[model samples]
Target: MASLGVFISCTSDAKKTNDKAKTVTAAGDTVATPEAEVGTVREPVDTAKYDALVKKMANGDTTGNWAGRKGPYPLAGAILPFKRIVVYYGNLHSKKMGALGEYAPKEMWSRLNQEVKHWEKADPSTPVQPGVHYIASVASGTPGTDGMYINRMGDKQIDSVLKIAKMQNAIVFLDIQVGLSTIQKELPRLEKYLKLPHVHLGIDPEFSMKDGSKPGKKIGTYDAADINYCSDFLAKLVRANNLPPKVFVVHRFTRKMVTNYKNIKLRPEVQVVMHMDGWGEPDLKIGTYRHFIFPEPVQFTGFKLFYKNDLKKAPNRLMTPEDLLKLKPVPMYIQYQ
Candidate 1:
């Protein structure tokens, strides 16, 4: 269980600079200096060239879902096809959670930087964007007092990751695994940080547990409505703050994990990525992306690589940037855990 301090601010000044683009990372009892604006936040999305870019992002997919009938023209600072985002995903508390937790800070950054170079070399046309994806809401083994079975990481936990990303001027993603809770209840809690331009969001449907079962006992699901709720939530924040577009990520490995793909709405303020979160040998992983992710297109596509799980068996190997770029509608958002 989290301590009482988890709900409270870690530092007195943490909340003071939150609503601006220049927020700070919390450190012990004080916050760091105000953050410099990161990423291309103010440049408006060009409607004159938007359609051509989305078509290029399609990479020859004949499916009618490429751009997916958008509900809003994107605001300035959309970073989808313009540059590929390579991210490290994990929870900070446990090493087993992912690469972010498995290695010391120095080693983790070295490994991540190596990946950024790999993708850049493989696809020179699309510059690589660095990002850190932290699991802000983890699905726990036992039900907590609220019966949500979720372990919510608070101000200190989030501040730690933000501090690290600040070094490279990289983006930060706060992911959610709702367990028995709903998106409506969980997302609003992080508004203080989400209001910033560089901090984005990701939702894992595998642990959603919509039917009231324990999180790990079975894979969970999220319908188009749940996804729409998050999009609307982030969209409102963007309009209110005049910040850059937030890249909203949805994790998927199965068809049921995300239902009614056609009904999920897109807004100018939010860029939705339907990420392939499955893990396996090359062939199996490729099949999962083709069967589940490729067929029903969202606004953007992302691929997740498992550092350990992908190499567990014979012929074990990780997929290289060159390997992923070969797919139809190449994934613009790449995640490693």
Candidate 2:
């Protein structure tokens, strides 16, 4: 939470004049100014070649060329060689979770497969991993029996999504919306599922309720410490199970949702992807990505496309694979809600 006081304002204003220019970290917080330089200045990454590569990919040239390849990280385990991960985000029992939940199970899987095939046709060399990202733990507007402001799904529900992913040899992501509960409380409950090699995790900062407010009443946040705790938790699981590194995805659209990104520890056993979870027309979506996800550097990145929200505009269309491939750092993971 941002400090609220005259002192805080004064301090923020003081940073504006420092020789070490204030810059936004991946978490969207201003970096602290140091009294003196501590290390050699780093050169900016050259994206000219990367842009050309994606441009070619966008034009239907799959000839084994792509940027932001997700391999050699070794932490990704059997799902190695990261390519594009297209996920259907929703809950099987609720229509509000997203598009993935609105259709019949078989029909939903069919739609997901069709999208996967589309991407494969676009870029044969880059493998597209299909995923069903289920909201295993839902954030409730009212606090439940545990006063966590959350409602967790039963094992049967989780297994349903897991089974679908397995049928397609795809991966499963169990997303957590903590509400008034802390990660400490909600994450451990899902450890059993996360122990599986093919299963990963997603945390929604929008419903975190860092200030003890009800979910959906106001936006929430997750500090770097919270993120680190999740990483450390998953790293332990991988070590204990002798499994591959797990991907820890944290969804964010606004800057405040994630604070102090520089402090987020990247471990060999865990990969972090800062996912852009926003909804709008193509232009608004692109601007949000450029302003939020593009400037923030993390281990990896993801983009979310909302079927209903996206179609609210005149075009009434969702972004195609070609349209999204143009992003500078091609999203390693893409989600449809």
Candidate 3:
């Protein structure tokens, strides 16, 4: 991770004032005021260039040559008002793999690496563009279980994922499943990746547990204080890096997962997108969003469709872009399982 700091520069000018009441000036000569020293003005970034880049991204055309092409596509202004949402659920750790069963013991770590390679190779047909954001689980083991924390792949994995994201032009949301650990404790360790402009944070409160309780059974709820701490830290981190605002993702299934959400103070600099991760029947999922989330001021809501679960239900409502747009505050991201 690069050192987080703001860059500032100053320029100075000096001017002399004429104290004499009588001034003999040449014809057509204007008297100049004593030069007062003025501070140097920082040059503004080429916003037009940035806008053009954004337009290219929105049009799904990330082809032009750019000078500083490092991480994922800059999503500063690419996100539209009522665009469809796409959410991805997966972990880098082998033990906590996705339900796809594609990754296994010996190959789990290599799987993500290989997946990124595949994604890069298929960028022309299936680019990991900005419309879809990838959520990589940092904490290993089960969602609610406590276990040893490891980056396993270290910086190599982080760089690999970031490069893939850049090539695909997608955002990376670091999913933090806080188990026995507090949000405060886990944040610092994940700060390395969060420093990246393309990276954001996701909180799985379902996995958050009370001081002394069982993991799976304990459904932790974040009070205003907890949410504030997380948001504030992220906001500062983003500002320090001179990057665009970071999006904070909160997953909610049952009401208990997010209690007193109305009271949580959202930081102006940070975007708080509340997602409904309820996976089940389509009607039931819609009902959950309508009853609990629609009335709130959340910017976005998320719908998760299980390949096996939702596919079996009656009517088999798999949420499409059209179904999501009908919601009051349309979901910004849709999670596919």
TM-scores for the candidates: 0.88, 0.77, 0.62
Report per-prediction Cα RMSD to one decimal. 5.8, 15.6, 17.5
- Which residue pairs in model 1 clash with each other? 44-76, 45-76
lDDT of 1 by residue, 1-337 (tens): 1111122122011222334355654545323322223332455667657767667667776766564434567777778767899999887777777888778777889999999999989988788889899989888876778988888987988998887787677889999888889989999999988887788999989888889987777889999999999999998987777667889999999999999999999888899998999888999999999999988877789999988789989788999999998887789899998
User: What does the lDDT come to for candidate 1?
Assistant: 0.80
**lDDT values, one for every candidate:** 0.80, 0.70, 0.49
Candidate 3 stretches greater than 4 Å from native: 1-85, 93-156, 312-315
lDDT of 1 at 330: 82
Per-residue lDDT of model 2, residues 90-139, tens digit only:
87777656756778778888998898899888768778878888888887
Instruction: Name model 1 segments beyond 4 Å from true.
Output: 1-20, 24-41, 67-72
Clash count per candidate: 2, 2, 10
- Of candidate 1, the 10-residue stretch with the lowest lDDT total is 2-11
Clashing pairs in 3: 15-35, 16-34, 16-35, 17-34, 72-166, 85-332, 85-333, 85-334, 86-334, 87-334
Highest-scoring model, TM-score: 1
Residue 328 deviation, candidate 3, in Å?
Answer: 1.0
